[model samples]
Target: MTNTHQRPLRILLAKLGMDTHTVGITIIAHALREAGMEVIFTGLKQTPEMVAAAAIQEDVDVVGISTLSAGHTRNLPKLARLLREAGAGDKLLLAGGVIPEEDRPLLEEAGVDRTFTMGSDTRDIVAYLNEWWAQQLAADA
Candidate 1:
């Protein structure tokens, strides 16, 4: 169902693997909601399979995974591969939290659409998703 007040963007926000940083994900969820998007938070320590399943079940446009435990290299790629295998690779994949600058290019190469560093504004994430949604719709058309 569409939201009348604003274009609805469904998002599944989760923490991958053993990463326990919930503060950033919580803040992002609040920001997305404030921006008129629907958000589903999957809480901490989520497996790649569970994340992909949630994204499919929820039919979310975006899947945001937070990796503060330095597992982005290992986890993000595996998650992307899993999503692809599940036929949800078209869904946007975004990551944040303690991501080092040097790893950005590698993560992008690994199919992560966007990466946010510490101190980046929440509004930036909201705007990125909105733009991404628009682009996806255009591409589909």
Candidate 2:
């Protein structure tokens, strides 16, 4: 995939709320990096505010939150609101880990651009990101 920007696509991956799970997000970080994307892993125990601030300060193209503690309904929307409030409404917002099929609409209504359920292929994630980025570049062009 061709990156319109000189630098690789920048993405911020975070562990939101009280979720202690890191294995999935770690693997994702590695996969994104391997795909030549610049990844900023915010470690664990990040708040919606912190992630939003990092996303804006880092000028990332995407923000991904990983949760396995059932905080998706609460945290994802908060982060989305914060990002929009900070004028980053265009940044792709993604949720991963343990999200139920039923809650998908709530998340979408709250401005989450995508969700990757548990066991989602990292290759598919990479392809999705690349495709999304390409579309954004095309739109701009």
Best by TM-score: 2
For every model in order, what is the number of clashing pairs? Answer: 0, 0
RMSD of each: 2.8, 2.4
Model 2, residue 94: distance off in Å is: 0.5
Task: Report, for every candidate in turn, its global Cα lDDT versus the true structure.
Answer: 0.86, 0.91
Deviation in Å, model 1, residue 79 alpha carbon:
0.2
Off by more than 4 A, model 2: 1-6
lDDT of 1 by residue, 79-141 (tens): 999988988888889999999999999989888999998788998888888887776666655
The TM-score obtained by model 2 is: 0.94
Candidate 1 Cα errors over 4 Å, as ranges:
1-7
State the lDDT at 115 in candidate 1. Answer: 93
**Which candidate number maximizes lDDT?**
2
- Residue 83, model 1: lDDT of 88
